[model samples]
Target: MGWSLSLLPPPEPELLDAVFLSAGRALHLANAFENKCQYVLRIANLASAFDEDPALTLDEAIAAAPSDKMLGQTLHLLVDRFQTPVPEEAVGLLNKARAARNFIAHEGASLGSSYIWVARADTLIRHAVALRAAVQALSLGDCIVSRWVSEIEEPNVPAPRSWDDDYPPMVDTWVFGHFNGLLEG
Candidate 1:
């Protein structure tokens, strides 16, 4: 499809800044987009899971998460419920995008790089472009997620506040800073 400015909401300043930081600092050019999009997918799945099984909790979702791309697929499946259709091509694009991002973050090299043989970065970038288009198709209003979070009755999964207190404050400064940017209002 042709690039259409009319189809997208104006980029939010903070969102743009986060995306830039993802590229410049995180060195994951598609990091912000992937993270935000993943959350969007999660919101959708939660809605569906709740609709089908109201008792379903985040732990249930995590439990159901497949070790494969199903973890990612679960998120995208959420959009399908809102009658917002994403092309298979776009889904493929996002896969490569995240894969490339994983490589850069973990291995610091693309598939063709001598370091480790994996998928090509070019293939990943192509998917990134397609994912951008899909994300643009989602209105900001659609992007907003409001869900009920309750105290865990089970002594399982980590607590929400643990993010702030569990780790050595100094050691997690960089991690918290990166994610905190993504969580900013």
Candidate 2:
């Protein structure tokens, strides 16, 4: 005869809260990284296509690049098609981040159930924190690439609006500081 197992107790509210917070941050950072990749690819495409088709507008150029591709494919295009020079370290970080993002997207919920059932809330939180770190590092690399793109296209691009003008004081400060820190490194 097979033995029956009792259901485990629910996870602590605080542990659940931590997991949610970290998971949210990881997902947010992953999205931001994807956006940066799209921007880089679109701008690079514009730079090349504009000379050949003077009538091409930014919107047209952006539309020309496929947006449905996965992150790995997007990275490959940036390097191979656009000849964007990503540093070796940045490439490693991007790969790591991509893996983390994919895992969280595809299996996080399923794995989370197991962790919760086993009362491994700390492990779940740690996993989320690691994913967030990887994505955050990837974002820094994206920022560097963005800076490079801006420098190359400085003459064509207009001045950016001040952060303070668009965001509340607290948000503006945090935004400014976060970007400044990323760019500085």
Candidate 3:
């Protein structure tokens, strides 16, 4: 059977606002995630170079680092070349985040038609939220790798502050709670 847009009520302004906000946030988060991946890759390369040559200065190690690569290739190098031990759950999340980032960058405009044609703003919002979560997970893994590198570089220094050190208690709890549910289920 065919349907008509006239049969449905106009989209609520509040819902449209939510959809745009969520999608924008997802895009920004995806950008941050990619940057974090690049950083992790760079640091991992530096650490590996230093491991191979103890006498290499920091500048020399940085100079010896591999050239920049795409996100997928960087991740592969991190695992296969640098031997970073990413947990399976984090690897799954990282892959999903990469796909979500690609979709947002390349095909997100297709979702705009659904906003009016099918009045499916909720679907758009859900997609954005999932993208945000996946990117967040990937960024968290980046943080873990960052800490590992920091420790390797400065083993005598005291443990550094956590990423969430400034977050309010409720927000911290909520964020970790969501991840716990995602991880356990």
Clashing pairs in 3: none
Query: What do the candidate models score in CA lDDT, each in turn?
Result: 0.40, 0.55, 0.59
Error of 1 at 15 (Å): 29
4 Cα displacement, candidate 1 (Å): 47
lDDT, candidate 3, 1-185, per-residue tens? 15434556546545444445545554665566677677777877887898999999999998999899998887677666546566787677567657766765555434544634455656655554554454455455445454555666678984557553432233323433333333322
Candidate 3 ranges beyond 4 A from true positions: 1-11, 81-84, 108-185
* TM-score on alpha carbons, each prediction: 0.32, 0.60, 0.59
Q: Which is the winner by lDDT between candidate 1 and candidate 3?
A: 3
Task: List CA RMSD, all candidates.
Answer: 15.8, 8.1, 7.0
Question: What is the lDDT for 23 in model 3?
Answer: 51
Per-residue error (Å), model 3, residue 16: 1.7
Which residue pairs come into collision in candidate 2?
none
Clashes of 3: 0
Question: Between which residue pairs do clashes occur in model 1?
Answer: 93-127
Residue-level lDDT tens digits of model 1 in 1-185: 23322344433434333333433433433355455555556555555666777787879966654333343564455445565675565555556545544544543322223211222334434433333333322212112221111111233643455433332233223322544633323
* Superposed Cα deviation of residue 106, candidate 1 (Å): 2.4
Error of 2 at 155 (Å): 6.5
The top-ranked prediction according to TM-score is 2
Ranking by TM-score: 2, 3, 1
